[model samples]
Every structure is written in structure tokens, then in C-alpha cells.
Target: MAPGEKLDPLPDPFILQPPAFHPVVPYVTTIFGGLRAGKMVLLQGEVPLDARRFQVDFQCGCSQHPRPDIAFHFNPRFHTTKPHVICNTLRGGRWQAETRWPRLALQRGAGFLTLFLFGDEDVKVSVNGKHFLHFRYRLPLSRVDTLGISGDVSVKAVAFLNSNPFVEGGSEYPAGHPFLSESPWLEAPCSRALPRGLWPGQTITVRGLVLPEPKDFTLSLRDEAAHVPVTLRASFADRTLAWVSPWGRRQLILAPFLFYPQRFFEVLLLCQEGGLQLALNGQGVGATSLGQQALERLRELRISGSVRLYCVHC
Candidate 1:
């Protein structure tokens, strides 16, 4: 990227079957095939309630005593009155000039999601569904071989997502799996697979507040074969709340409708035998039959409407 050029949110890259990391504290994991552009790493964890700071490092290797060359250091300091994300590189036993991004994207004592998008010019990071920081590279991508995170943080999972293939049968899109852009949180026209992979008993919850007097919103769940098993539609335009296949041969399902304009609410779609159950805030809204396809085959969630979605979890 040119100096001072704007870095927009990264477009969705193809995701492989997310390899999981459930490491002990002071974690260090090697990147077996090395890092490059079009690859991203997802770190999910919680900062301690009393966390003063924590650090994540992209190192040349996982060596200690005389630590390996640090290609990128991400340190978030909470000790100061105003928090900042500190970025730097270490080479020849000296630290480079540090860059501070004045954003405290991590929440105290709560889980946070951080995505590091690797590119030729810089590494852009997003935290908890929002853009956080970026750091220009001071080392070639070739030298980095390990990833480490340490200090006052409880890590839940670390996943390395590589979109471009450099080896035979590498971590690319699986043959039969449905693929699409990763969902941009709170952004309409959003869609992605359930990150942990959907299961039979899992409940998919979408929580959002309507943007003051919203006209309409729609959320859909689809199977691998492109079958939309269940779809929820809320429209003030037509004064209707309906389920999928409105005009198709399949019958439509309607719920005991209620509206909370300009207020927060959650829609829970639970997968179970016979059909999908819909619940608003905690009570049953309705049920819609999605045929007899296996639960594991339901692979995608698509949401697009005039609303700001805060969370979608299964």
C-alpha cells in the first residue's frame, strides 16, 4: 500500500476447514507452511478482568532464552488511563519504533475476536467485529514461522485461514462445501457459515435493534444443496411477518407477530426434528418445516435488511 493510503475492511477470502487451537497460557504455535498474503489468522480469547496488558507476536520461531526474531508484536496496554494497541518489530536484539493505535477493541473479562489479515504491504487487524489497527511490515513474509500470544489473556481458539493454495490438497475450499464471503458483522448483505460448524441441536441466534422504524428485514438458513430451509421476513411495508416459500408450492408459516421498533430484540432459530423453531426474545414465534435433510447439511446463514445485527451465534 502507498504511504498514508486508506485501508478498507478486507473482502471475504475463501475459508478452509478452520483448524482449531486450544492452547495453555503463554501460547506459541508454529505456522507450518509460513505466512503470506491472502492469509488471515483468527484469535479468540478473553482479557483478564485485572489485565494490565497482553501481547501477540509473529516470530521467526518459537525459541526462548534468546527469543527468535519478532516480525510483528501486538501489545495492548490497559494500565494507562487511555488504552492503545502497540505495534512493533524486534530485530538484532532491538525493538523498532512503535506505533500506537488508540483503540481499545478488547473488552475486559469478555471474549473478543481478532482477525489479522496479511497482505504484501501491511497487516490489518479487526477486533470484535470492527476495524482496529494496521501495522506496516518491517520484515519479509518469508521469515515468519511461528505465532505466539502471552500475558493476562485466556485464549479459546486460534485458527489460521489460508485462501490461496501453494501445495497439493492444501487448505482450500472443500469440494462439496458451500462457500461465500465471510459475514461482515452489522453490515447488511451479510452471509457466512456457522464458524463452529452447525450441528443438530445447535440454536442460531441473531440479535439486533431495528434502525428506527425499519421497513423490513430478512434472515435465511440454507443447506449445502442451496435449499433455503427457513427464512424469516419482517416488513412494515406490507404489515406482514412471514416464513419462506411465500408463493411457492410449500405453505407459508406465520407467527404471533409483535414489533419493537427502535428497541433491541433477539430471534432464535433452533434446529430440531420435523422443522425449524422460531422464537422472539424467549417465546415461540412459529415453526417452519425445511423438509427431511440431515441437520449437518444446513450450512449457510444469510441476513439482509434494514437493521444492525449485533451478534449471530450458534
Candidate 2:
């Protein structure tokens, strides 16, 4: 532990585990303990074909009389031809100024997953594994103890993820191939840790299903340095992989194609002792030089594509 650094505890890994899948609309639930900075909430749902607007709210209390104070009000309006996201706060049944983003991150009738990354200053909304927008904090974050959602949306499920690795669950460091149960995850296009940080003998895994209407997808690793090393991409056309780096190095890797409606693929990437190794399914596909300085500098794992990202083990 660093001197004077606070060891913030993470919520129990099982805290947000839903009892069962919810495929209904106008859903509401408590966020267990409350809302806190560094907690990410995942909402998987689909907008109805005739949907107009839907709202996701973070409430300080779950009272119904005279209405509870809302800490964060995230509403997506797609009524008319135009669509946008409105962010606001409500106190004493009154709303404050609103901020709007002119983008519809969710599509009608398409199952989508949105992540609300709660931070000290604001909450960043990412839809379908991409950065969307951020809304600043308008109320004391400590007061937010409940989550509520309503309007024209079909909710598949919801989960909460606390970023700290050492807090409640024993996800800190898993031996051998860490199963899906021992990792902190986001929808995708996200950065998560391996045990704690980059270390020797650590392995990286990404498992997802390629969508039928897919073109290609990419996964990259970054560092504080300007040079980001090892970006792995798979081409849907010929079942080939592109192993490249931000420094302009490319290695074409060919892997056998698998056909089916599922269209599943698992890519394992690792950077250790010798160099970078990438494998698809069980095939050794490509490699990249693992610079010595890049060891501890390797910060995150990112995947972007038309696939339902299952798990990313870093």
C-alpha cells in the first residue's frame, strides 16, 4: 500500500448478482447499499419499436409519498425524429437545469447494454461497449441509495461493479486460468485489471460471440507512454487476425473459421518473458515483441466489435 493512500473497499462481488434475469420494462430496484464513486452499473435492455422515451434514475431514498429525491436523472428521449439524452437532478420534487447529448446510443428493438460509470465528479454513460456522454454530479453522491428505471424499455438485466480488486470478493489473484467468475468486467471497449497490475505469468482472455452482421473487431492494450503496444483485430471475411501496434507493426494471422448462428470466438492474449502471444480458440496465431519497459506499463485491455463480449480475463 502507498503511504497515505486510502484502501477503498469494493462492494461484495455477489452484491449486484441478480437473482434471475429480468426481461420486463418499467423496472426498479435498490442499488443495495447505495451509490458510490468508482462503481459501475450495467443495464442490458432494448428499446421498444414504438418507444418514445425512457428514464433511469438514482434516488436517495425509496419513498413514494411526495416522491423521493433523485440524485441522477438520465432520460433518453426518442419520441420525434430526433433523439437525445437528458441529464438532470431532482430535489424536493423539483428538477434542476438539464444537460442534453444529441446522440441515441441505443437502437430500437435491438438488445443493448449500457454502462453507467459512477465517479466522484460525474457519471459516464457508455452504450454497447462505447463511450457516450458524462453527466456531472448535482447532489451529494453519498445520498444516492436506490436505483429506479421506468418508461418504454425492455430490461434484460442489471449489475453493479465496484472497481477495487481487494475489497470483498476473492478476485484479487486467481491461480492458473482464471475462470469468468474471478474477474471484474464491463460490457466491452473497457479496461480491467489482471489480479492487480501487469505482472509476469499473467494471462489475458477475451470471449465473445461475433454478431451475424459483423465486419471486424479490435482489441488493444495501452500504457502511459505514447506508444500503445499490441492491438489484435479479427477480420470477419477470411477468419484472419491482425496483430499490430501503435508503432506501425503489423502481422497477419490466419485462423480457421467456424460457422454457426452462435459465431463464437475466444482470443487469448498475453505479454510476458519472451514476447506477445495471441491465440484464437486453441490455435497459436501471432506475436509481438514485449518490450521490457512495457511490462508494468501495460495498463488495460480493450475490445470493440459487433460481438456479445462474454468475459475478458487480464
Candidate 3:
């Protein structure tokens, strides 16, 4: 694809399946897969109270899989609490459960069981054979401090099993998951060669917000077609970037917002002479103009190599 060309939409990575049960302890454990690969349930502990007992639970999707995938329950009534599950998908995103199970009854001889089942288009939960909660969408594989069960029972086993192929290989958070360092601002790299055609008065503006960080980073805009790079420097200490017009000027101030490594950032570029406009995610902060001087000489716009995640005008 040409520089600045649009990209296709992201695919869903969640697999559907029946619910499963498992046993767990007070420590953080993976009820299913590693990292954010398949379906993973995480567990933790919290303050103890004199209320009904509940077993913390983590559930997964069931649109594809037909069997109970995984489960984890804690032992030692008040001795150990705070269990959670980290539900993840093959693509990205996560959900967490941390509510205590209400003081309820279970099937005779049945201990407190935390279930993760796939129900219709949502993920449902049941404790001691009693229905509790349901999630409408697939949860991404991320860390969460939620997942509680309340009842008059104790946890026993934390099992992991799946009858579906789609949900087997993917883990909740595999050890080899890709990692991107934290940054205050990011920019999509430009192409090396400018477009072949030319049109005077053609202009494009690239804009984005500054992330919340202690230091500032340089935002570089490259005209891949022209093989040029324009750099903008800004700070993310305050966490905001507003729009600043750069007409007939070299640099402009964009919006102001705290940088969040977990959230999506945006950038906007307007191409008037060409009758086109492009907005991108991860384009970096600040504002600037690609005036008729150089934009008129370009044919293609694209993000350079290894410059971080890039999303086209969405």
C-alpha cells in the first residue's frame, strides 16, 4: 500500500465455548493459557468481611467452543481470598471479574464452583449452581483485580481444558506477547518518495494530542513519496494537546491530553487541493501544515517502517 493509504479493519480473536471450573489459591495463577493468547482467568485477594461468601470467577466466550474451557477456585475460606481471572482473545482486549459470590447454596456435596461459560453472544457466570453475571462481548486478555465468589463453601481445583481448536492454542497472556514501550507521543513515519504529479494550493495538516508522560518526544512527519521528514517536539507532562492553526506558518499547536499507553491516540491531516483528507491513530502530537510547497509534488503518502501502530483516517 502507498504511504498514507488506508488499512483494513481489525478482526475478532475471541473463540466461543462452554464454561469450565477450576481450583486456585491466593496467588495469581493462569486458569487457562499464557499471557494474552487464549482464555485466561486471573485471581486475587481483598479485605475480609462478615458477609456471605463468594468465589471469585473469570469467564470466557462461547460462540465457537462447545466445551467448558477452564476454571479456578480458591480454598481456605477466610484464610485466602482475592482471586481473579484474566480473559483474553487472540486479537487484543481483556475483561476481569472481582465480585464476591453472594452467600448461597450449592448442589449437595458440591463446593463453591466458579464457572466460565459461553452463553449466546455473551459470557455468563454461575456460582454454586446459581446464575450470577454475564458479559455481552469477548473480554481482552489483561490484568484485573476482580473475580470474587460469595457463599458458604470452599474452593478446590483450578482446571484448564477446552474442546475447541480455535480457543485452545491462543493464551490469555503468553510469555512471548509483543511489548511496546511507554511514550508521551507517537507519529506515523512518512514515505521516502514524493508523488509524481503536482497541483498548486494542495495542503495537508497533521494533528494529534500529547500523551501524559514526564518527558517530551519529537513527532516526525515524513512525506514517504518525497523522502522527507518533518519533526515536531512537545511535552506530555500536563496530558493535553489542543488544535492550533499553522496556516502560512511552520508549526501549529494541536490539542492537549494525557498520554495513556492503554488508550488510542489520534492524528488528522487534510488534503484540500487533492480533495482528500486523512486522519490517523498514533500519528503523534502537535499540528503542522504540508503546504503547497511540497505536498503538490507527491503522489503517495504512507507510514515509514517500524514507527509503531498506525491507523488511517477512521
Per-residue lDDT tens digits of candidate 2, residues 57-115? 99988888979989889999988677988889999899999988886887777778787
Error of 1 at 213 (Å): 53
* TM-score of each candidate structure, all chains considered together: 0.50, 0.52, 0.26
- Residues 38-89, candidate 1, lDDT per residue (tens digit)? 5667787778899999999999987786878898999999889998889999
Rank by lDDT, highest first. 1, 2, 3
Deviation from truth (RMSD, Å), model 3: 18.6
- Cα lDDT of model 3 by residue, 220-298, tens digit: 3334344434443333434333332222223334433323433233343444443233223312233334555555555
Question: How many clashing pairs in candidate 2?
Answer: 1
Candidate 1: Cα lDDT at 178: 14
Worst 10 residues of 1 by lDDT: 173-182
Best candidate per TM-score, number?
2
Top candidate, metric lDDT: 1
Q: lDDT of candidate 1 vs native?
A: 0.68
Candidate 2 overall Cα lDDT vs. reference?
0.66
